[model samples]
Target: MFLECQNINFRYPNGSMDVFHDLSFQMKTPGFHALFGPSGVGKTSLARIIVGDFNDYSGVVRSEGMQNLLYSYNLERLPDWSSVGKHLEKITPPSLRDRKNELIASFDMAETMRLRFSQLSLGQQNRVNLIRYLLQDFHLLIMDESLANVDERTREKIILGIKDMFPDTYFLYISHNVIEVSKFCREILVFRNSLKAPQVITVNGQDHKLGQTVSKDKLEQTMLEIMHAS
Candidate 1:
């Protein structure tokens, strides 16, 4: 197993309501997955708990065959002192230079590489920051709306490229975009409304490949399942 969270129960300090109760989930293998639900449903909280950011919770959060978990969000910013290309080159291993170059091109960031981090738009900045993480060694990455401001077409390309290139890595993609998650992710753990039993529902997604087109019927079915679960 890659990860397991058994009987998780949590409430914030000085807060009135419990954020999660008897919440449990597991990732059986390394692949793309998602934590999805309406706002204030504790998606981010659960992610923090999984990454050991929140320790007050009562639960057994277990991970086997994995060394580290990294979290990335949309609001994270890179240093503005150096050019994006320079920053990437400084941190990337010499052996992975080819791969880094491939990602830059695949993300349609070849032109912006020479510009400073601050010069890029919000969407561009997110992509660059994500590239930095991608070059690093890690077992799992939790992306919390990390691709938020990017256009749909570009975001799709980046996602497909990442899935194709990092086939062995595990990803927990958190996003509000239902169509995107249903179309791209392998499995989605949808959180139900507050006070509901079985707070999380696991649904199989389309998991479309890099160059394949998913039929509308299949995509709609996944979306409907997610909607009903939510």
Candidate 2:
């Protein structure tokens, strides 16, 4: 397993509540995985747990080597707005740094490379945020709804591009789009009831359980319930 957790648990700083409850799962070394749930369900929190930023949690969350690299984008704060390309260059190597222009071209953000991150459209910045991690050669990738700011077209482009362009990099994607998740990932992990706690791999496919293969009506009901609850 590239990443695994056993009986993991966590709560906020206040002595009030727990975020996760005895969650456990193991991940293979490759392919894309999707995590879907309503907002604030600890999707981001789980990503934090995977990469080790969130130590407040109990239980064992473990990964090797590139785990931290996989999660550099779930930032505690936003990237500086001075320059998108420059921010990436600081962390990325000169070799990968040179590809910035080409990536910009591929993502249709060439015009914004020199512009301040604040100056670019939200979609453009989202592309840059994605590219930052995509450039790294990590064994696993843990992410949030980082693509939520972008349009549907760009989102699809990224889903396809990651598969085609970076086959070796493992992707752990999180999104609220159930239909898109079905298409974008080989497996889906559904966070029903709450983001914290043991997530249900509602459908199973590929080497892992994808997630619950709900009917269209049930899926819609799930989504509606999720929206209403959180």
Candidate 3:
């Protein structure tokens, strides 16, 4: 399995609410996966747990490689007024350092490479954040609505571009956009109920007792049906 979680349980400190209960699943293949759920249902929490951010949870969260990367909606903490080139240098690794120019060009970020972080639009900043990760290696990449600020067309372009650029890297994308999920993801993990195990929908041309793989349009329809039923 590329990633696995077993007997997971968690809640915030001094809080009466429970975030998860006995949640478990295993991902054997490497590809794009969509994690769908309403806001505040522990979607972000789960991402953080997978990336080793919050260790307060009780469970066995294992992956083929310990190295994981995460980018989320919150950009308030990002450096203000820092030159784009400077910011990129700080996050990019030494091994991938030489590929910085290549990545920037591929993402159509060359024209704004010299602009300050605070000067770009919200969508531009998010794109920059995503480009930084593309230069590195990770066992799993978690994007918690990192592209929410961007428009739908641009978002789709970037998402597809990422898939093409990093064919081998696994992605766990948290989103509510059904079309995007159906078009880009090979598997769907719907967290409809907070305490229950997530319902799985695979679109890798694999037969399963629950559902069968189909065309992107068919997959979208099937996903909507399942999501509404959930």
Candidate 4:
């Protein structure tokens, strides 16, 4: 598996309910994978846990040496005065320095490079952040409803473009939109609750060592059912 989590458990401080209880998941293929569930079902929490933002939880999250890149809409941690280029430089690996311009041009973000982080629109922020993360060598990408502000058309365009542009990279896209998942992901995971194992719906043919089977239409339908049920 490219990513695996076992016996994961967590709850907010001073909170009564456990957000996750022995919730486990494993991703065997390396492509675009979409995760969908109703709001506040630990979707964002899981992303934070996987990326090491939440350390209070107990479990084993093994990536097998694969580095992860996390992108989200909130940017309060970022310096408001810093330009997009400067921010990217701060996080970018030295080896990937040369690919900076190429990546910017690919995302059509050359102009935004000079703009301050505070000056860009939400969609522009997402594009710039995504490009910056992609320029570096990362094995896994976890996006937590990061492009919610961006319109459906633009989000689809950028996401599909990234999938086509980087065939080998693995993506875990967390979203509420089923149509978007149907269009982009080869595998879809639906979370009904934190206690039970999420429903796995594979769209494409088995492409990994741990091959499995499912259909796109079926996955979309299942996603809708789960969402409505929740």
* TM-score winner: 1
Candidate 1 residue 229 C-alpha distance from true site, Å? 0.5
Candidate 3, 131-198: lDDT as tens digits: 77676667678887777778887776676666666667788888877666766776766665554554
Give candidate 2 misplaced runs (Cα > 4 Å): 64-67, 72-82, 89-91, 97-99, 194-198, 205-230
In angstroms, the error of model 3 at 134 is: 2.0
Which stretches of candidate 3 lie above 4 Å from their native place?
69-77, 94-98, 195-216
Candidate 1 regions exceeding 4 Å error are none
Residue pairs with clashing backbones, model 3: none
User: How do all models score by TM-score?
Assistant: 0.97, 0.76, 0.83, 0.77
Q: Tell me the tens digit of each residue's lDDT in model 1 across 103-194.
A: 99988899999999889999999999899889989899999998989999999999999999989889999999999999999999999855
- lDDT string, candidate 4, 1-230, tens digits: 37888888889999888888887777877788867778887777888888788999998988776765564543423467778888888888888776776667656678988889778887777777667667766778887776666777667556756766678888888888776665567676666665555433234412222223445666666556545544
Steric clash pairs (candidate 1): none
Q: CA lDDT, every prediction?
A: 0.91, 0.65, 0.71, 0.70
lDDT of 3 at 124: 80
- The most accurate candidate by lDDT is 1
lDDT of 4 at 43: 79
Cα lDDT of model 4 overall? 0.70
TM-score of 1: 0.97
Lowest lDDT 10-residue stretch of candidate 3:
204-213
